[model samples]
Target: MGYSKDAEHVGALGAGQIAKACNNYLHWVHSASNVEALALAKRYGVDAEKMREVLLKSPGDNGTPRNFDRYRFTWHENDIDLVLDLAQDGDLILPMAALTDQLVKPITQGEVVRLLGEESCVYLGQTVAAREAGLDD
Candidate 1:
């Protein structure tokens, strides 16, 4: 399938879905240490350092793409798009309904870093949402 340059054609993925994807990815990313998560990302062909930059400095880290808000992580369209594209292609995301699964375990970025013993940065907007959803435990 061809990619859409016009946000109008692909349109917005909606806040709920975006939130779900972000939260799911963040949860997985932060669920384990840097070694484990990066290994997972590496298996999917993502550069660990690059993934950190994209997640920490991309628009996804700050807020939704539709909103022209400056985020803690200043975003470049090309970089952000590439990272999301890679992440999407990697199949590194959780199913959208993961939020409703009571049997699932809760994991946060804090624990990941603690386990890894290294500083890592991942999208925190999802962290915020997970907290709101009571999933950031």
Candidate 2:
């Protein structure tokens, strides 16, 4: 716990939590971005799978190549909720997290794969419902 360590020496408590929440927010946003791109590819009759494979190879932060496996749904929904709640309690406004929290509310384990697409590490129920409804592909 970076925050815990910081608190011990620097009196930092919320900083680490805020940083973590923001990072989680990015993950949700990227997950949605990937899923939406796949859905659009499917609509255009493009090879969605191939596109995902290529995109994952594309550069990310610091020009590092994206790894598809990193996006796979693996986190339990409860974990996401816990972070969102923490962010809220700390007066942090993680819009993406708030939105993602709502999105994951009804998702089930079985639907995580299809909704997140390739290499989804964390399952978000909202992604599942959106995919199942033919809205997210």
Q: Against the hidden reference, what TM-scores do the models get?
A: 0.23, 0.50
Q: Which candidate gets the maximum TM-score versus the true structure?
A: 2
Over 1-137, each residue of candidate 2 has an lDDT whose tens digit, in order, gives 34445442223776655666556656655655565565565544455556666676666232111443343355636557777788777797777667776664544333434533543323332222223234354
As a TM-score, model 2 comes out at 0.50
Which regions of candidate 1 are displaced past 4 Å? 1-40, 63-104, 108-111, 114-137
Quick one: best lDDT, which candidate?
2
How much lDDT does each candidate structure score? Answer: 0.37, 0.51
Residue 93, model 1: Cα distance from true site in angstroms: 23
The count of residue-pair clashes in candidate 1 stands at 0
Worst lDDT 10-window in candidate 1: 65-74
Q: What is the lDDT, from 0 to 100, of the residue 51 in candidate 1?
A: 55
RMSD for each model, in Å, please?
A: 15.1, 7.4
